[model samples]
Target: MAWMSLLVAGLLEVVWAFSMKQSAGFTRLGPTVVTLVAMLASVALLAWSMRVLPLGTAYTVWTGIGAVGAFAVGVIVLGEPLNPGRVVAAGLIVAGLVLMKLSSAG
Candidate 1:
């Protein structure tokens, strides 16, 4: 399924993003390799998903998932800040993603 591929790609995007932080500008070998691998895999999956999904809709969904996922990871795993403003912003992103999904379905 294209949607499933897109979902995995979005998750990989989150992984790569977090790995990038750990990479320390590519100075750290292990994290750098992980970041590169995840980045490649995420892009490959995203490209594959584009074969079936609309370009605009797919891209928006991919980035929205990545954004929300990364934010949650930061808060839950990395002990990053989670203020009211961020919560509201994340909610808005989720709302937009829901609208996009609904529109794509019909």
Candidate 2:
């Protein structure tokens, strides 16, 4: 359950990050509001997950998920570059996250 919450929080983090791009320095009312709301929800869920999950583990997983998710969204939805280096780096992040999860299970 805590892991699930962390995943949701991470997803929300991605949403808020993308929304921030559209915020136009907070000049755009709709995107700004959406960003704020998503950010708040992300934080809330992260905090809740921390109650049951170790802080270090939860934070690492949440951040890893957010980073990967945001990068994918940028590449797919925004037509951002998906250079070989970027792809390799993302794969490394996923590998690291998997390793962390496996270690933590012990």
Candidate 3:
């Protein structure tokens, strides 16, 4: 349950980040509101997950998830450059997150 919450929080973090871009420095009202709400929800879920998960592990995984997700969004939806280095970096982040999850299981 905690893990699920953390994962959701991470995904929300991605959404919040994209919405922030769409918000155009908060000049756009709707996306700005969505960004703020998603940010709060993500943090709330992170706090809920931290009740059981180790702080370092939880925080790292959360940010890793957000980073990779945001990168993918930037490439796919935003039509940003898709370079090998960026892809490899994102893959490495996922690998690290997987290692962390596996280690946490024990």
Candidate 4:
């Protein structure tokens, strides 16, 4: 349950981040609202998951998911650059996330 919450939270984090970019520095009303709502939900779920997950593990995984997810969204939806270096960096983050989950999701 906690892991599920954390995963959702992480995904929400990505949603909020992308929405924030769409918000245009909070000038856009619709995206701004989405960003705020997703942000709150993401944090709430993170806190809930923390009740069962180790702090380091939960936080690391949360940020890792958000980071890699955001990168993919940027490249795919936003048409951001897709270079080898960026791909490797994102892959490393995913590897770290998997390792962290293996070691701490016990």
Question: Best candidate, TM-score-wise?
Answer: 4
Error of 3 at 18 (Å): 0.2
Supply candidate 3's per-residue lDDT for 9.
97
Please say which candidate is ahead in lDDT: 2 or 4: 4
1-106: candidate 2 lDDT, tens digit per residue: 8888988999999999899988989999999999999999999999999898888888898899999999999999989999999999999999998887777741
The most accurate candidate by lDDT is 4
lDDT of 3 by residue, 1-106 (tens): 9999999999999999999999999999999999999999999999999999999889999999999999999999999999999999999999999999999952
**Alpha-carbon RMSD, candidate 3:** 0.9
- Measured with C-alpha atoms, the lDDT of residue 35 in candidate 2 is 98
Encode model 1's per-residue lDDT on 28-77: one tens digit a residue: 99999999999999999999999988998889999999999999999999
**Pairs of residues clashing in candidate 1:** none
TM-score of 3: 0.98
Q: Order of candidates by TM-score, top first?
A: 4, 3, 1, 2
Model 4 agreement with the true structure over 1-106: per-residue lDDT tens digits: 9999999999999999999999999999999999999999999999999999999999999999999999999999999999999999999999999999999953
